[model samples]
Target: MAVLRTLLGQALRTTRLSQERTLREVSSAARVSLGYLSEVERGQKEASSELLASICRALGVRLSDVLRDVSETLSVIEPEPAPVLVPVAVPAMAGPGTTAAELRSVRRPVRDVVAAA
Candidate 1:
């Protein structure tokens, strides 16, 4: 399974590097120790929500944007789920056009809702 912290760390590191900023600069701006920030970037340590916000602020990026990027990365790496068949009660139709066999359940993938997001 893919680790969330690793993805988060990668996204943060990518953002910082794209902006041409050093770890020292971000750590200093975030008021966190340089070693800790480095560890977080390397996926060696988990950062708290507050620390993540601070790091985002230091990097001049939004937390939501970072998370969205991580989510997209995860979707690409994660395996697709099997389709599920759900039974549905079909209402009776009073017309001659009613088809009994066509009122069966539908097969849908589990991640449809997630993919829409």
Candidate 2:
């Protein structure tokens, strides 16, 4: 599964790298611990909304802009697919007649999961 934290981290790291800034500098500006910031950049930890906002401000970037970039990145990484849900009817009793052909597979787009949230 594609993780939102991972994408968010990538966006933050990309912006930081593009600006040629070091973790210590940005962490200091954001008033966040250097170790914690490193963890956030590595996607090992999820930053709270307030922390994210502070990080964005430190990077001189808007939170909305970072979100937009993350959304675009996720879209590219997970292309939309046609909706599909197939159900297979099974007998109540187990028998040798059961076969792989009797099974059905269901597939749905990732957007569905996001929309449900």
TM-score to native of every candidate shown: 0.69, 0.68
Candidate 1's C-alpha runs over 4 A off are: 82-117
Query: What is the lDDT for 22 in model 1?
Result: 95
Q: On residues 2-117, what C-alpha lDDT tens digit does candidate 1 reach at each position?
A: 88999999999999999999999999999999999999988999999999999999999999999999999999999977676554445555257766566543323445634745
List clash counts for every candidate, in order.
0, 0
lDDT of 2 by residue, 1-117 (tens): 578998899899999999999999999999999999999988999999999999999999999999999998898889667665534334555367766554432234456655766
For every candidate in turn, the CA RMSD to the true structure comes to 6.5, 6.4
| Model 2: pairs clashing at backbone N, Cα or C within 3 Å | none
Give the alpha-carbon lDDT of every model. 0.85, 0.85
The model with the greatest TM-score is 1
Candidate 1 accuracy as TM-score: 0.69
